[model samples]
Target: MIQQSLVLTGKQKLAWLENEVRDLKDDELLICTIAGAISIGAELPQYNETDVTDCNPVYPRETGYESYGQIIRMGKEVTGFAEGDRVLAFYGHKNLGVVKANKTVKVPDDVEYRYALLNTLSCDAAKGVLKLQPQRDDKVLVTGAGTIGLLTVHFLKNYMNVKHIDVLEPNDKRRELAHELGASHTYSKKEQISSTYYDYGLECSASKDAFHSVLNSMKHHGEVCILSDGNKDLFYLTEDFYEKELKIVASSDGWDYQKHSQWFFKETVKVPQLSKIFEAEITSDQLIHCFEELSESHNKPLKVLVRYL
Candidate 1:
């Protein structure tokens, strides 16, 4: 079987690679993708070649991890899932791929493919939220209005019943979207955050300044859960972190996909507009062009959803 994939040939470079698919392992499922999502925080740095987390850049690498598809074939050992069942997996932006049966989550029939793509990040947000264990009355602050940040806000306000959820973001459009998504306040500058004290904070901006801002806004001994990939820059401990004796915990990927899906899939129905987080939608064929547009500063969208046939 031949598969076409989006590959990063070099900095600001993209190409389609046609390759042969390997035989499916007994524990794997063959998925025919319906759509995928580009995580701006995680992938953009690599795409723009600003990611310094690695000593050097590696070319001809795959670039995405969020995708939803139907199971075209399932291994005999796979029991819970079957052929034609829709699921969300960690596969990249491609028409078809093989994924481990355990790592995939079954998408509810009522959930749209575009919305199901969020399963991964939403689970990540839920993990971070669960780590901190914020209460309904606890004032929480989220730094960044990206998909992860906004999802953090959405989970806090809607699911967790957090009353005062404030967001800090530099972009006007994102800040406004944050407000619509149930943020009590949106601040673009640090000055606006002077008097606010939060019981907990979730850092999703992956910006050094934003990380520090989250630390600075916390109350004494306040806890913080970092959801950002932080690929482009290193985060250092700030004075507030030391002085306040803050507790910071970092989380990446979902803690439990199957368990979280039970709650998230149902939540999607109640919050139908939550899919609005994806401001732009493109077909799988436009992936290269989509990344090209994303490389530009002015072309930033909350998130881009890629639809595949």
Candidate 2:
């Protein structure tokens, strides 16, 4: 678990440890981000105990995963990296962290620190592609147009090359971005989401209604890849899947092989096979999950990336 490795873990094991502990109580730390992504997409449901919030709890202090600034105390055993070395960690959300050197991917010096700050989102993007590996002529529809949603589109567009691709998102801004990137067609939930057509559906929005929407959008006996790492609305999932005979696939965790090969450590853009994921990360800060000058920050965007000082 040194500076340039990735780790696979269940939702969160020691979440309570990341709570508002007194500074004196806090001891023994390595690299960690100031914030991490708590929300996967737009319009999510309330979390239940079973939902298993990520390493950090929910906001008042929602974690911003993008642009994470790592901190290491005076003394810590690190391998292949130094005190000032910039690194990326998935546990950066809600200021959550773990003693995970394996999952920490170091940012290349040539890359912007903010771009390395984007590695966490790239993890989410990579996980989405791993979860939903579309085949030829698979008419695909991605629900939501937020960070994960658009990145899901990127993976499917650049990697999968499905017969047709679309996004069911309500946000005007997001829908526009989806089109700019790769969505063949973008529709709001109110608009016609096709009477019935689609082989695969990805629900990244985590909206209460998205489950049913995917079910109804499918052409029967279709597969819906559940990539959103957020809590699922039980009532919605149960009712839709039972009524529609929908096939659901819940895929979590990223690729172990990619982690081992230093996918994150290498120059993200230079990785031709993975250029789009990094492209999504590079554009992520200015483009997606944008927070305006508003009253509260969390409810606004899909993910927030900040410039670290």
Candidate 3:
């Protein structure tokens, strides 16, 4: 079978290419995509061809990690999921794809497809929050107001019950949105932060300066979790690190998707603001033009959602 796939052939290039769909393995499930989201933090570098992580980055890279759909078929050996089960998987922008059954989590009947699409990112935020172990009285600081950063704020304030959470972001619109999503204070500049103020911090901006600002804002012996991809700007330990004796830890993917999804589905009802992150929507066919717009400097959406169905 031939399936259409969204691929990046080169820097700032996107194409809907055709690919052969091989037979599924015994433990795999075939999914018909409903919707997916562009991970701006991770994909922007690949789109711009400015990824600093690789001296000579490879081209024709498959882009996307947040997609969910209904299972159209299951391998003979697959268990615990039916043909029509709604599931979220790490499959990219392809409309049809196969994934291991263990890699997917069933979407609840009540959860909307848009909300289910955010399962991966929500779990990413939850992982960091759990690692930080924030308390109700503890003041928190989060860098960046992008999707991951904003989601980090949501988890810290709503789920973890952190009383005070400040955000660092330069964009006025994003800062305003951050305030609406429970950020107590928002700063456009690092100089505005008070020294030794926050008990815990999370770096989600993927900027070295933002990381430095996080370290500067921390109280003595403060702990911070770095959640940014950090491929765009490299992070370096600052003087505050040695002076204040801060502790820094980093979290990437979620520890348990199935377990986290069960809790996330029930708890998301309380966080209606999650919808704000995915305000921009486009059809799968418009992806090429969407990437062109995203390549321009001024194009910024909290998150761009692609509807396949």
Task: Please identify model 1 stretches exceeding 4 Å from their true place.
Answer: none
TM-score of 1: 0.95
Between candidates 2 and 3, name the one with more favorable lDDT: 3
* Per-prediction TM-score: 0.95, 0.65, 0.96
lDDT of each: 0.87, 0.54, 0.87
Candidate 2: RMSD over Cα atoms?
8.3
Clashing pairs in 1: none
Candidate 1, residue 237: the lDDT equals 97
Regions of model 3 farther than 4 Å from truth: none
Give the worst 10-residue stretch by lDDT in candidate 2: 5-14
For 90-115, candidate 1 gives per-residue lDDT tens digits of: 87978888999998899978789877
Per-residue error (Å), model 1, residue 181:
2.2
For each of the candidates, give the backbone clash count: 0, 14, 0
Over 62-101, each residue of candidate 2 has an lDDT whose tens digit, in order, gives: 2233334454541345456565655665543323244355
Write down the TM-score for model 2: 0.65
Which candidate would rank higher by TM-score, 1 or 2?
1
